[model samples]
Target: MPLEFVHSPTQQTFDIGSRLTRLLTLLFSLVIVFNTIFAFSVLVNLKSLDTCMFLSSDCSWSAHIDYIKDKAWSRVNILRSLKFTLDRLTLETINMTFIRPLLEYGDIIFDNCTAGEKQELDKIQHEAARIVTGATKLVSIDKLYSDLNWQPLSDRRTNHKLIFMFKIKSNISPTYLVNLIPLRPADPRYNLRNSSDIPLIHCRSTLYYNSLVPSAIRAWNTLDSSFKSADSIQSFKRLISNTPKVPHYFNTGPRRLQVHHTRLRLDCSLLNYDLYRKNIISLQACLCGDSESVRHFMLFCPLYTSYREDMFESINLLVPGTAITLDLLLKGNVRFTDPFNSQLFSIVYSYIDSTKRFI
Candidate 1:
């Protein structure tokens, strides 16, 4: 028996490995030869599809997201293979170039997904970052994102959706999509606060509640009026791109150098102060009979005086006349210029090496 189905004039379906048991139609006489069902709302999402985009009996993307996850993890395997040869910058470039596009493709399907499904996607990114930077699974995922300046997938999805919403708002989207966005009309004589937003209608189903346009609108309405009022799409993107709160410094150095720097920044060192706080040591004091903290380890310790003096002199040469504050050198928290030069890092790394703080 052949599968019978109705086709929308605009949509063209591919053999996506979906099985159709039966089709409901008044005309049961209309017979069609096909094996798979249409991926409702996720058609032709991006050019050159890699995995089969399937639609189960229910119109859901939970299974589709799993296909995407499998593809993404395959790329992460490649990234892991090249880890020894590639630095953080190169690995991140590879991920953005190859893996990211796949994860972001057909983002509309994500609208109907549950929070747990979205978390599966987020975990892929977290693992990718860990593999690239050689960070162990024991490392805090948040710390890895912060140190590497990587945005979580959920935020990235929201950003992408808002960009599409911007296109619709700016009248740059296709007529079909623009018409589909549920917007309420405003009065000419009076002003209303919700005029620029999509109406919060009662959704009888959770699917309707979390669907594409409504969720996008909810995110859209949260933005400042100035952001939405951009004259051009590029301008709008610029405004929203900066919505993610960036850390003080975005590390671009190699992973070999970065792992130690990350450990120092996170205060995961074996300092007696840290040890004492963890109840591993009785007192937070140095062998020189002074407090053993990062400040003491870097600047004031009597033991590493020669190495510390060398580090100070080298850092002075690199950043002439600027005050060497604790945060500045340790975390590279510069307001204007990045003072974490290669020479300065070498000096600091060398100083720590001599003190054996890391070992």
Candidate 2:
């Protein structure tokens, strides 16, 4: 190999440059191939990320929120289309049994949602309330909520979060949520309003404060002693179900009859002649010659004389000296006691059934 006499410097430089260019080209090709394979892998494994398969500790909630919104809105659209046929009770049942479960499932995602997103989600529930109760656009949301015996979505979310925390604290739930929440001794001398309470650790980030542990701690700390002292998860759930503010009447009467009574309470029934004035129906109440309003039909109509006596007897038994006025009949202004309210509902349901004879 050392037999060559001499070589030109320019030729040697050119040969070295050619070899270097080939090496650079091979390296660039490998880099492109690896990049393409990585991109493909990301696309293929995208779905696994939703359930936190790869990143268990720091699961992203945005995807979960998107999924909920898409699913909830689709159901809402279906419910909206069925507004004319289903009555308030049936609609509420569909919401509680069907749509509500969808929202409540994996609700931890809601904790990460912004206030605006929460409100957007709540609007779907608001729309449902309007559809079920036959409330017009002008009806106040508060009135519809009270009549329907529904809790606002925000409150529901809060309740779910608190309940979840209670489960974790009581060792009923086996999840990583326990690591975030810590138990502290209650100060007996202070006489805190809430008996079963947990101390909240100060968090530097708003995200941490708004998370399941801290937010739940805050909510659980504000609950009354009776609720905090529930012995089991079932007992806790029962106490929450019996909360006076949001009453549940599923056991009181058949749903179909309950709907009739609900319609009467809202004064938006198909039989109401007031709907005819608004061009919603063709016929007015025949007996009165006036607009067959709920007040006229329920109170003043001579047609219901036989049934009216029984209705009054039931009402009096429920709440003695309870006045029957336009506002009371329409808006349910009087607050009858528990079993009384149930009894009153039964009376109203019977009265509604009696009126069907004339139709």
Candidate 3:
């Protein structure tokens, strides 16, 4: 009987090599799996974050149906869910979290919040307060994101109510888009604040201008409550309430009316009289002298005496009588009595020149 005892170093080396290969292969596979997961996550975050919910399933952060069915405000926790969802929103998810909600419930978000579910109403107020308080520190986008991130999540009621709010916000005016930033918090521009312009949940007052009573009534009541004389209060209220409404006449109105009247007259008379037909004479009649009528403007008006004489002397024409009649001047066909023409001519020319400058 014989026993084999010889061992080769080469055999040992081969065995170790096989084990190492297996270990290396397993490690590489694990790395590949990790890498695939990482890549998928990055892609999902980048691609879907900016987009809003495509379906009800996409917003399945809660069992909303159950919460709604119960009609239990405490259990709803809509605001808290919204806060959580808001945290999930990134620059990538801006449209989904902020813009989409704005487009949907913008009116409620900006104004008219009475229709909002209680939870959502609370969230809106919470958000508004946070925005106002943090405004000074929120100069940049990153800071804004961070501040919002720390805000407490809204409750279930806020979440369910937000659906309607988003729906209403969608109809806001383009000007209100500025409200996305905290530029003018109290200015009330762009429907961001309540206004009497529309009948909405917050501004549906039955009194004049949405008041419970007339302003005069309110004032009188206040005075009467203080023990003022009844007759005095009544008289004061009547006097204030019956104050006459004064018409405000803008300067432009009267000026335009006069200009229109003159333009029409001049345009109409142009054919009958050649001299008067020209805008120069017509404008002079409308503008120069104490007698504002067109007839006084062209012929006998004293205001233009010095001006007319100067023109006449410059052109080497005999100074026509100040008393020259309009009809005589028109028929005379006196072609350029003065080389510089009449004062009326210069006035009209100047008027046209000024008018053209603005245009």
Q: Which candidate achieves the best lDDT against the true structure?
A: 1
In model 1, which regions exceed 4 Å deviation?
1-52, 186-190, 243-255, 268-296, 300-303, 333-340, 356-359
154-266: candidate 3 lDDT, tens digit per residue: 32222323222222234323544323322224445576333312222233443222221122222223332222222343443343233332111111122322222223233
Which scores better on lDDT, 1 or 2?
Answer: 1
Candidate number achieving the greatest TM-score relative to the actual structure: 1
The C-alpha RMSD of each candidate to the native structure, in angstroms, is 20.5, 24.8, 33.1
Q: Write the per-residue lDDT of candidate 1 for residues 177-233, one digit (tens) a residue.
A: 898777676554557676667766577898888888778878888888999889998
Each candidate structure's count of clashing pairs: 0, 0, 27
The residue ranges of model 3 lying beyond 4 angstroms of the native Cα positions read 1-7, 34-149, 153-359
Worst 10-residue lDDT window for candidate 1 reads 33-42
Give candidate 2's TM-score: 0.56
Cand. 3 Cα-lDDT = 0.34
**TM-score quality measure for candidate 1:** 0.71
Model 2 clash number: 0
List the candidate 2 regions with Cα displacement exceeding 4 Å.
1-63, 185-196, 243-324, 327-359
Error of 3 at 297 (Å): 99
